[model samples]
Target: MRNYQPATLKKNVRLASKFAYWLDCELSEMTSANVEDYLIHLHQQGRSAKTIKNHRSAIKVFCDFLGTRGILQDNPVLRVPSMELPEEIPIFLTDEEVDKLMVIARLDDMFCEVTLALNTGLRMEEMRRLEWRDIDLKFKQLTVRKSKSKRPRTVPLNQRTCKALETQRERYGHLVYVFPGGKGGFYNRGIWTEPKMRSENWWQKLSIRHIQEVIPSLKNLPAGRTGRGWHDLRHTF
Candidate 1:
């Protein structure tokens, strides 16, 4: 729990529960072979390497807990081999794709968010938490205080990003969040009534789906290319 986020903790708990349910015998009878077999089962189910790794981690933690309480003489999960993930190439949008995306974004009233994402390479959560107070337009810089690393950093603004911010300011500068949610709050995960509503998760998925429809290459990406989120915009930057 020291380093785990709330979401991660919940996921680990869920995975551990599933692993326990899969074992026919008592918890004390569980072994490394069982853990390995479960991993193989996950692989057979077409779960991605990253997902299997997470499952393995949760099982390890569960086994460690059992060992600490003398439920097991040894931690069986320790004997399980670590999962090896295949190399993944980062995918970014082509210049042409960006051009088309920008045109569509402008029409959809997402120009500011798209512009900031491409230019600053900020994560969706970081952008969602952005507020007017964190930006210094006079100095052309903004502070990301709630970054994934939990460390604040300053990001410089280019002319394009500055212009986009100026436009956003003129429109919704009085709001607390730079990109307020549908109800004028921080962006949250959910469907919205209007496409212009800014929900980072939904927006990324919607945009990617639209782009894939327009860009044949994206729809025909080779195996192992798996980017369907706003992080792709960061990579594009």
Candidate 2:
């Protein structure tokens, strides 16, 4: 109900619902102690601090809403201290690393997609939904739709990006998607497949293979927990 992006709203509602289900008590019965106990429960379940923090925030907001409706005297979240989060520095790929990736990517089907990410700083999801119609090679501009910000923005393309796309278009221009999956449809499996976007995981898998092929040590690099991924390409650019 709050002004949240669709994905953020969904996460908030899901966490709030989980808390309500766990408590199995009326709003009036909820208290600061109950909220603290819920946090303990989450910690017992092995949820990470960041994840627990999100749950805490959702419950806190719900408690505030209840207060606004004259249902409580104080916000329970205020009684509890915020979770201590481990600092994480974002890692960006080096130019040599990016160049190495580019060399291998040029031989793969995702070369165009890879080039766009390196050039435009578009997210994986944004790259997935990108279509041939959204690109103007002559003008070196790309239109991103349904972005995470819930707004469309145009990304100006570099010469390398345009050239890569031009080559991709020459080969796979018949398909609606700029980066079509193997089956001539969207890359991911979902309810809506219109001009379906490729899976970020799929690209990551290929990228990892290529990276390891060049430098074996990179293969062992932690990927999910503060490791290199597609986002690093955006950071690199």
Candidate 3:
């Protein structure tokens, strides 16, 4: 069966498979022209350049996977034209902005999110995948099961990270997850019910509100889009 089932691939794999399906070309037909056409198709679909590049990469991986299975003699992704991404200036919080956020933290969820993002370089996916069993207070470390690569990595829990986890432990016991589970268990409906290991959403949402609240002109402005808002603190270290 020459079946290309997009659903069976893992989440990331599903993305790549969809690209192959949309292109309507066999893995054997992959070439520079084919890749250019696929990228054009994605661009026409209102995908940003970055998104188009990502889809191409995903398809590249799919081609490689098929090549390994002897479905194709060569992987065409090896020769596809690469996208030249525009350079972006780095964004980091100044001492004043950091202090301002801390001053406004109070007992809000955003406060903890700010502290943790500053302390650890955990991605949104890693935070969402956090499990109670992965943390070892005795070892003073947090274990991260790599969602993308399926590898496990550990980072020493800083004082703030430890305190945050401890507080969450006391507040939401028996949930078996670092953050909280929903009424349906792991189906994150929203803030009141989002599956998370260490969610900064409350912090993110609150921070956005606080920004709009403080700046009159920004009240009606769109939210920040260039860099990850919480990521500034992550790069602070």
- Name the 10 consecutive residues with the lowest summed lDDT in model 2: 184-193
Clashes of each: 0, 0, 1
In model 3, residue pairs whose N, Cα or C atoms come closer than 3 Å (at least 3 residues apart or on different chains), thus clashing, are 110-203
> Which candidate has the top score in TM-score?
1
lDDT tens readout by residue for model 3, 1-237: 123322224434866767767766666766767877778887888987877877777777677777888987887767777789999654556666666666655434445445666678675556666777887877779888764445788888877778877776665545666666433211222243344444334433445666546534334534543224545556664
> Per-residue lDDT for 22 in model 2?
93
- Model 2 misplaced regions, further than 4 Å: 1-30, 44-47, 58-81, 84-87, 182-195, 199-201, 204-228
- Per-residue lDDT over 134-206 for candidate 2, one digit per residue giving the tens place of the 0 to 100 score: 9888898989877877789988989988988898788767778887655321232221223555554555555
lDDT preference between candidates 1 and 2, better one: 1
Distance (Å) between predicted and true CA of 58, model 1? Answer: 3.4
Model 2 CA lDDT for position 126: 75
Clashing pairs in 2: none
Overall lDDT per candidate, in order of appearance: 0.76, 0.73, 0.62
RMSD of each: 4.9, 5.2, 6.4
* Top candidate, metric lDDT: 1
Better of 1 and 2 by TM-score: 1
After aligning candidate 3 to the native by TM-score, how far in Å is the CA of 35 from where it should be?
A: 1.3
* Model 1 lDDT-worst window of ten: 184-193
